[model samples]
Target: MAKLEIVSPVTGSPRDVWASLRCAAEDAARDEPQLASQLNSVILSHDDLSGALSFQIARKLGDSELGAMTVREVALAAMQADPSIVRSAEADLLAVEERDPAIRSMLQPFLYFKGYQALQSWRVAHWLWEQGRDTLAFHFQSRISELFQVDIHPAAKIGSGVFVDHGTGIVIGETAVVGDEVSMLHAVTLGGTGAERGDRHPKIGRGVLLGAGAKVLGNIQIGDYAKVASGSVVLKPVPSGCTVAGVPARLVNCPTEAAPARTMDHTLADVVYDYVI
Candidate 1:
């Protein structure tokens, strides 16, 4: 596999990302002729990233209450109302291509990755929730859960450049705040310890990585650049740049890498018993 050229959000504009996506789509069409028409309609036909994303999201989230065309219009309106949506979408695409070893092209996530699709759909739902359209926002949430198997409450504030890989069984509570550039794997939960009222969920900091099946409960903070190892049940705050693992997660060691999230390095160093309680 060729090394992917990392494109920073600061360096790569939305147009550049869109162009790359279009080029990838063209290549995919050439390689797999049968999907040419689908690719063209879903990606090449659109004028911008928002249009393509809106179309794909709407098609996936559409239901009897709202048809695909209607949902598409709503999604488009949301994207137009806030240009940040498109920008965030681009950042997310870049993050996936950069971090995910399995991904070969920018077009792959746009067309097929359920994690990407679920997150974008949540964005629209969040917009609706912000506008006081609670019913409609909940509707989108239901469809996303049913279709994608990833349940993120409409009010959860998720930052840009987040990659929720193999998103199945992932649950984020309403008050959960996932910071920018965070990478979460399958079956991870940002949830409450119990039936609490307000601000019950965990607050994940920037560039954090929550490994597969990790359950972070309550209002504790997982500090920036932290790593929660796979299947760990975290109940307390984890300091920045530390690695935690176990049923009730404990600090195993301080990660040497500045941002383990970006590196996606799951391996831990020799356990520093001094740090463990």
Candidate 2:
């Protein structure tokens, strides 16, 4: 894997990025003292700039604990865990550029795209969880949820090629399982039934499209190629090749053939391509 050349496009300086990142780190530490101490354990060799830009970003955005962690620490950690996180973010930026005519001149992904921050954060939490550091992992996850209005439990299993749109108010429970090529809109909840423990959340198969405000509760299975309509409350397992909608979500349309996996090629450039002139 190639080394990541992450520099602030605004300053065109790697050093400035590092300085800003440190400042952000300090601010995050101040907010979540315990997390700050733990992070310091890992980044002891580095200097604390006190006014780390990432921390300021979190503060400015009114992020909860989880959001601050995403910008301050988790993102960089993710870059270390899987270079693919960086690659995917870069690709998404390019895609947004290609598709959205308005974003041709924008330069600050760090400030604007929570999706990038969320994915980067997830990489670190996922790695931590794998290493049996659930406490720290859960702390980071909670921080992300507090800041971004996006809640993805550290234990939730999510495959690659996953796209989360309008990320605010999105929640994925601890036991939830999502497969590859899944696309979800805003206000979606892949949650559990009641307050039960252990594998109580929904299991989403591959190539599923969950519309905005869709809720799949309990230990139900959403088959591959399934579509849950907007504002639906699904309480049962859906068969493959079907589209379900409404409260107690029922099959609305059963196509002869299930849809293929949703395309995951949309780059960030494409999404932000349409910049407001």
Best by TM-score: 1
For every model in order, what is the number of clashing pairs? Answer: 0, 38
The residue ranges of model 1 lying beyond 4 angstroms of the native Cα positions read: 1-15, 274-277
lDDT of 1 by residue, 1-277 (tens): 1112335754563337887899999999999999999999999998878888899997898878899999998898898887777777888998898799898988888889999999999999999999999999999999999999999999999999999898899999999999999999999999998886988999999999999999999999999999999999999999888899888788888754688888899887775543552
User: What TM-score, to 2 decimals, does candidate 2 have?
Assistant: 0.63
Q: What is the lDDT of residue 64 in candidate 1?
A: 85
Candidate 1 residue 266 C-alpha distance from true site, Å: 0.6
Candidate 1 clashing pairs? none
The candidate scoring highest on lDDT is 1
TM-score list, all predictions: 0.94, 0.63
Compose the digit string of candidate 2's lDDT tens values, residues 1-277. Answer: 3433433322444433333334554566687787776446433234432222234334433354346555556445545566655444443333233223434221223335565456545655776787788997887687678667888988888765555665788999888998865777779999977877887999999878788899999989989877777898998898875677667676666641344335322211212211111
Error of 2 at 249 (Å): 0.6
- Residue 6 in model 2: shift from native, Å? 19
